[model samples]
Target: MEPSNDIKGLIRQSPPVDVSKPYDASTLKGKTIVITGGANGLGSFMVREWASHGANIIVGDVDDTAGEQLVASLTAQYPDSAFAFQHCDVTDWDSQVSLFEMAVNVSPHGGIDIVVPNAGIILPDASIQFEEPVLKNGRLPKPNTKQFDVNITGATYTTHLALYWLPQSGSSPRDRCLLLVGSLASLCPFPTQTMYTMSKHAILGLFRTLRSTAFRNGVRVNMITPYYVSKSNMLKLPVEAAFLSGTAGGATIEDVIDAATRLIADEDIAGRALCIGPKLKSAGVHGVEDEDDLMAVQERENNGQGRAVWECYAGDYDNVDAFVKRYILLLNAAERVKGWFGIVTDIWSMLRRK
Candidate 1:
């Protein structure tokens, strides 16, 4: 049986994104940003976006050549705004720490305002086609790759390093934010892409849980989920296979610059996922609610009262100061408990003697 002609026609359609709104350059004035995997792909586009927004950008990527080239280009274009590029492997702790420290040193403000953990690789083996051959047979097959370690684990390492560095860099935690570059795969379950999907979904959960972990620290965390971003015009397809090929080529780039532009416009929208796509509904939304409405809902749910919850974990605190304070409090409480127990025991013993 031949594939339907409609599928071919649908592939001819241009990808969705409005280029009408010119990006605002002043969106990130006085802000400093660090982007990982920023030499190419979505990360690179973000670098330009942030730079154009008047942000001092520090880009980290494994590709030295491209990373250097990008830095040189940015430096030539925006010499006033500090733009530095360093080779960083997200999976490596040393590299991450070095990158952050370098960024802090270069920024005139002494701290980074935004840390975009955007560095990741989509391993060729990540495709889900092997398990569901029937569904993927008619569709173009994706390369089988290690999507989890590169996509999910890489992101984790990046976030962890950012968390580790931010508190120590002499910056108020409230002023720092972590923007995790997630994907549409994280929300929807597309066939044959389970690894990428699962990892991305897990990332969303991590960002959600991070709110609780970072609440006391005053750090805000968020994620951006982008769908098929255009990278190359040549790869633009007239069929499903061609469409997949275009994305794989990383040829057709998306309006990622615009997405970052929009991100800076809103402050109330935090600890949520911002999905980018062709249609309005295509931009999937989650975890966003007005402050008053949220409070009202919480009040009703809690009978007009609400208590904040804190997670007690040893890993969150880096200093002996917090630990010593907690230990002393616990010890003091224990002493009081012992005194009361002794009194009760003495009363029991006295009764026995009687």
Candidate 2:
């Protein structure tokens, strides 16, 4: 028999997010969120927005000066809201553990609702001399792997901890989530920045695999992949040069914040990924034309003004391989059998220890 044309079983289509529409910001109120590398750049931007919406935030970063300054400013502005800064080196596991402990200690409810593994770095020297050999006794020197350490290992540590703590803190399973920050490099290879590209690809892989089964743990997993962002006036020349050379325009910090807010505020969304790029004034959605009728309808609804956020391949989980499908089914079956008895026993054990 000929192969069927139905791939929907393996990958379901994801609904497009209406960026022009506003989400309920009130959903973030009173939630305690932990963000790694929340001292500057996109992390700082998210911190301000989440705090403005009444979320208590714990920012972890190695930049003590910037972290302290940011915490002070936010604390003063939102006096009733909790804001804390802890020194965190993502490359170090112990440092991350300490940061999580501090976050829980500072939280009013003694629990963490959301965790954002946003810490990342791209060293200039590492990228510049990625393949250059250091001549020492004619032996090939060990290539620098700090980029992987911070981007992959650090993210892994955060993921492990988030799985443990998020469930412990929330009264409802819907409140638990892990938000991973990836880059356009996650989807496409950047030859100039090999280490950075490799690291992001690893993160994208983690996001894909984790989302497939995170629901079994009652945890929601979402990710945001952003294109180059030109924030400073000094960087505009290079950004313009890239644009002139046929490269796509960079996304804005506001665009990223908007995408992230939607994920944080909406509890029904899970196993989703959003890619943020430059805004466009076209009447049609870019890069999605598999369904001509649906695209035409979307174009009519949008009219013009193409949004920066687009859903990535989020349906792959719907039709997973046999192993994954069986694993998820087995987990669901076990949960049904265990029921409240397991939960009660676990609670009782906790209470007795306390």
Q: Which candidate should be chosen as best, given lDDT against the real structure?
A: 2
Model 2: per-residue Cα lDDT over 1-354, one tens digit each: 944433333332235555567789788898999999899888999999999999999999988999999999999999998999999998888999998899888988888989999988876468657656577798766778898999999999999989888888444444777999999899998777788899999999998877756765667788999887657131357644664366556788888998998987877667788888886444444644554322233434335545677778655533334434465476675443232234447667999994
Candidate 2, superposed: residue stretches over 4 Å from native: 1-16, 132-137, 170-174, 232-246, 280-303, 321-354
Query: Would you list the clashing residue pairs of candidate 2?
Result: 10-319
Name the weakest run of 10 consecutive residues (lDDT summed) in model 2. 5-14
Give candidate 1 misplaced runs (Cα > 4 Å). Answer: 1-27, 124-145, 168-174, 232-241, 244-254, 280-354
**For all candidates, what are the clash counts?**
15, 1
Q: What does candidate 1's lDDT look like per residue over 1-354, in tens digits? A: 933222212112112222233444564776788888889867777787677767888998889999999999988988788989998987777888899889989987788777888776543234645465444667766545556666677788878877866555454433566777766666677665566677778777776557435534545565666665655221234643564653432212444555555554344334544555543211122542332212122333224433121111112222334444565586674443223224447667999994
Question: How does residue 219 of candidate 2 score in lDDT?
Answer: 77
- Cα displacement (Å) at residue 279, model 1: 2.0
